[model samples]
Target: MDDMIAGGCQCGAIRYSLAGPLPPAYACHCGECKKQSASAFSMSIPLDYDQLQVEGTPISFTTTAFSGRAKHNFFCANCGTRLWHSGSIPPDSITLKVGSLDDSSGIAPQGHLWVSKKQAGIKLDQAIEQFDTQPDDVTEWRGNLGQNS
Candidate 1:
């Protein structure tokens, strides 16, 4: 709760921390996200991949995305709770599910992505930004950390 974002899986088998303010959070209404989360949409915070630090190894599941790119979902191997996802975009970023956060009080979706696939009944509030697709470039939004392997 000290401004740094931290969270883990349901059983505490995996943990992660974000060193700084999270990039804008967004609601992804893409079909791939919905099926992966088993929900109407997936709430996520985009972070430079190097900014993510995890305490445990997560089980990985790979799937071809709607864009035909390969994506890997990482989850707590013990609790079966999805933790984060990587691939298709900059390998330097990972979309962490907001539900996995330890404290999500200040976190809110700034916009809706892949809105075309959104459910008919799931209307987004007017104040939030909406994009038909993901942002074109996030190079300027890189975190203040050195590259990580």
Candidate 2:
């Protein structure tokens, strides 16, 4: 965590630098995430909004979350690489897409969300903290992942 983590869009239009200490990432199996990732699940690392410094303008679209709050998705205009997501409910944080990282070799999801929608072919560690849907208690959820985070 001493060195800075950097990444950018495929076309190199939108670049970002993420500061440490990095928070634990999570694998989301929600339908929206699957569509966004075009895969079985989407990986996200939540950090303070300012922790991720952006260098270029990114086009964004708004979508409503299950919480009924507006969630904004930002992507590169050139390569259509989805960068991150921000929600109105939590104005101070951003969910950085793990795929956008230049070197994600060291990152791994500490928890899973929307497990009910998880792909049939995917297998998860039984010991990992997971939920069929969003956990009701943020504290409990965080506590469960604290060891790994």
Clashes of each: 1, 0
Candidate 2 TM-score to native: 0.90
Instruction: Report the C-alpha displacement of residue 138, candidate 2, in angstroms.
Output: 5.0
lDDT for predicted candidate 2 compared with the true structure: 0.83
RMSD of candidates 1 onward, in order: 5.7, 2.3
Encode model 1's per-residue lDDT on 108-132: one tens digit a residue: 6776778888888987887666767
Q: Which regions of candidate 1 fall more than 4 Å away from where they truly are? A: 88-91, 132-149
Q: What C-alpha lDDT values do all the predictions have?
A: 0.75, 0.83
TM-score of each candidate? 0.79, 0.90
What digit string (tens of lDDT, one per residue) describes model 2 on residues 1-149? 54788988999988999667677788999999999999999998877667778899888889998878788898998889998888743346678899998988888789999999999999998878789998876435644564753
Number of the predicted model whose lDDT against the real structure is largest: 2
Q: Which stretches of model 2 miss by more than 4 angstroms? A: 89-91, 137-144
Which window of 10 residues has the lowest lDDT sum in candidate 1? Answer: 140-149
